[model samples]
Target: MTSTIGVTDRRALAAAQSSPPPRSSAASRRVTPPRDALSVEPSVVDELLLVCGVIGTTVSDTDTPDRIVPVADCLNWLQDLQRALRRDDDQYRPISLLMAQWKIVPQKLLPLVDSCRYDTDLVLTVAKILVILTKPLAESTERAGKLPIETKTKTTEA
Candidate 1:
């Protein structure tokens, strides 16, 4: 048995027949921002670092410039996380956790953090990154502390 469209089902059926639901003029092509800020949980640090690790691995690639979206997203995530941590005085543990990650992150993000670039906002973000998680590079003193064994040592003997 076939039933005609009921009063309530008319618009719904018309909407279903439409290829794409009509959107208001207000719905532009702009990307909307995230719904929520970074979570307050401390465990978010691990996931953040994981994203850093992925960025680090691909950062050396030749096409990295073309992949700006993900890099921007990761950087924004970092900033969001920093803001969350700073809100809680006693819970701000990024310094030590980031101290451990300094070896992995800064080197990868170095390209984006360059202060000489034209983007002052990037430079500002770089400064914030330094304040948040950047640490001094580890030096190679193992080789630096010793001179070449074969070469004559520079003696200070008088």
Candidate 2:
């Protein structure tokens, strides 16, 4: 899990991320953030990606632990991301495509859910992610489909 930083590294690794302002911050402040404050990063997208990666990897492995504590923490982290995603902010709109690309489907989480059935918080967080992902995605997320294929097939009579 440390290989791909998640909520645990939120503070230490926060300095390097340079995500664009969400629609909520369309009027971004001009004042420069203090250097120490750089570690106080705003975007949770990378954390979300990491959480998904962790869950996906754990699901694929046959010898995964009986209870993945990190996944529980990931659920908490995802809850924060869900809150950010639920806001009526266009800047965060691009994240929908990310969620789709990462395959954050309800079924994708069943393995962990099965392991954590006793934990109500984890169950509810999974439900929240499922509910949020089921909604119609923002138009910008369409780019998630073909972003890798530029499709520039032009032949100049070679």
Candidate 3:
């Protein structure tokens, strides 16, 4: 009986040592490291820029010939959006409205959502931009049902 107990304890210890530690929930898991910049293809960057241009042109207030906005302008707009999101502003509404009006579906917006399996810095960059653009919309929608109209107007005015 003593020998059997010893063998059982040894087996349990060996199994514990051999197995990996249990993982946390998916929400608590660490994000995968972004791909290196040099490995990103130029065509991927260009495609991302093209999508940005389409969105920028759709949202721009100034007169753009043929409604074709420059890629650089789109990049600047993205940077502005990033800053606004950091400040927790409502700048997301314009971009959201533009996307709706232009019928730019998720499939056309950020290729990263569909192609993240391909490791690339461009994909990561686009993914971050999309997150910034969509987060405010998500938060606002959540609050819309809970907040009174007066409070909503006051928050927006601020």
Candidate 4:
């Protein structure tokens, strides 16, 4: 009887060992971030456009007129929107407006590129428009970054 009990215990132990360990609820509930995680937030748009502005400024400085044009246009657009929203300190409205504009304008603008046979004139025009469109988000993102993380965190926490 002792030997039988020992065999049964060993079998149970072996089976337990072969099976995977149970996961904690937190571990089991782990979620994969969406592929477009950045796009999920309105501020993310501003941040991205801020980076675009930085890139555009760099390109413009480097005298890469062709490449700079597109990047510059994106930057300018973001900056303009930022100015408009901050004009009377009426923030939050610009994000909704800019996002709507981007969705609509890109559809019309993209066709112009192909329609013009991707010529220098057309490229420049697109770049100009993009610069104008990007200005607002860029400035807002810049200002937002200027605030200390601790301040933002504390404000949100409270």
lDDT values, one for every candidate: 0.43, 0.53, 0.43, 0.44
Best-to-worst order by TM-score is 2, 1, 3, 4
Top candidate by lDDT: 2
Show pairs that collide, candidate 2.
23-91
lDDT of 2 by residue, 1-158 (tens): 35545665775556546654456552453233232221212344555555566653443356765444444366666567677557523423445545555666643576667777887887888778667766664433343333532123334995
Against the hidden reference, what TM-scores do the models get?
Answer: 0.36, 0.45, 0.29, 0.26
Q: What is the lDDT of residue 135 in candidate 2?
A: 69
What's the true lDDT of residue 53 in model 3? 47
Instruction: Pick out the ten consecutive residues of candidate 4 with the lowest summed lDDT.
Output: 146-155
Candidate 4, 86-130: lDDT as tens digits:
442222233334444446344444544544445675456555555
Residue 30, model 2, lDDT = 29
Q: Which pairs of residues collide in model 1? A: none
Clash count for each candidate, listed in order shown: 0, 1, 0, 23
Off by over 4 Å in 3: 1-51, 54-92, 105-107, 112-119, 136-158
- Find the candidate with the highest TM-score and give its number: 2
Give the total clashing residue pairs for model 4: 23
RMSD of 2: 22.1
